[model samples]
Target: SSVSVVICSGDSVFLEGAYQYSAGTYFDTLTGGNNCDSIITTILTFASSDSSLTAASICFGDSMLLQGAYQTTAGSYVDSFSNAGGCDSVVTTNLTVSSQLSVQLSSDTTIVTGGSVVLVASGGASYLWSTGDTGSSVTVSPTSTTTYWVNVSDSLGCLGTGQVTVTVLPAEYLVYVPNVLSLSSVNLEHTRLYVYGRGVESLELIIYDRWGKKVYESSDASATTRSDGQCCAYGIGWDGTYKETGKPLNSAVFVYKLTGLFSNGKEFIESGNITLIK
Candidate 1:
């Protein structure tokens, strides 16, 4: 028996010639297990393989594989290969690598002149900061307005920098006292008594004689004889008199003490001398 068929180019079924395969109709003859003659016909088809594409993204120092080779650089590549289906294949590869470097830092901040603040830095592999800190965050207290810088590095050896500023304001709890007093002797208008401080919550003024006896003491909710610019727009003082006696205190050198609480709830203490002159 005979068979006929149309085969494409470059294909064959017989082990006949130097060509691996060619498009043609072929026949094979073999003896079966029963020693009987068996005839078989085969048809083959072949065509050029299509061009292929591959993409890649690799880390800094890693290699990009293209064209059956490891390439350290990034670029377009092409390679020819023989497909298992007996076709010539052309592959086109476009590769990319990760080499970007970036860093982030927290924004500017303001704090009380004596307060502290925390600085935040990004997730860099390593860091160096101007405040001598090497961690991702640090605590700082700047006496005045200060700017801090940080140097950061990634695993790929790329470096980036970030900066932040901290501003310091004047303290709210400020205290001031005069060194001398006329003790109501200069004039009736000069007898105004007050203790001067800023942002004070409550105040206590105590006067002591030479023997440490508490001769005069005034307390919270002090009255502002005149605005001497104390906390709460109020003032604190004693009227040159004794606490135990209604008589005016003698004109002499006397010790005075001032104790108060700041607006932020901190304690304040101060002591000084005032010369009570006639």
Candidate 2:
């Protein structure tokens, strides 16, 4: 009685099983209980470290580790696993090295009064503003409304751009003239007289004798006005004289009137009489 051994594919064997030849390698004892026979064969197969390893979904500019029995290498990466059995799988993962950069304006509002803004890039890089300015931030004082933009570039030569808007308002003020009045004179030594009005943009003065005869006329006159305090009256002064002669005329009663133009293009008139003692 001798011992026998058998070995199966992917399985080990020892001298314990009953003597028999099977579909796998076998060892036996026979031939007058003194001879022995043996056989051996090798089987090759393959398997992954993890069959459940899968692909990952992520946002742009993000990195993820590909977990698998096999180590990942640098190259173009593509997901080869198909949607089988209602589950996602990863067959291989490839990697590509890139110097990626992106730019974003500090403010989304294009119209801003006055201030500085920041232009940032995903990858730290150099920045250039629209006005030939270079820096991560730019302080701009635009005289008028303007559009500003930034150009950014990474060390790897990737480029990105962004823009913002700025607006400037105009300065203004209000102009005012209070009250304007006219006075008349009669019996004056001279037929003509002139008076200025307060805040009077343009003024015209005319004088008439008792018979309604035009005696004196003046387009230019001296005028003054009081801008502050109550009980203050604005007035104009005129010398009694005829335009034809420097000599004073005989004393008489005369009617005088005034007309004025305002900044707003409105006209005003005043009439009265004065007596001259000559």
For all predicted structures, in order, the TM-scores are: 0.35, 0.26
List model 1 lDDT by residue over 12-125, tens digit each.
444333343666555677789999988766554456466788886665567866778897777888988777655667788887766755678987765667889899899589
Runs in model 2 lying further than 4 Å from the true structure: 1-194, 221-237
Across 47-79, the per-residue lDDT of candidate 2 in tens digits comes to 222233334333235455644323233443434
Q: How far is candidate 1 from the true structure (C-alpha RMSD, Å)?
A: 18.7
Computed on alpha carbons, the lDDT of every model, listed in order, comes to: 0.69, 0.48
Model 2, position 76: C-alpha lDDT score: 37
Q: Score candidate 1 by TM-score against the native.
A: 0.35
* Candidate 1: residue 170 Cα off by (Å): 3.2
Error of 1 at 19 (Å): 99
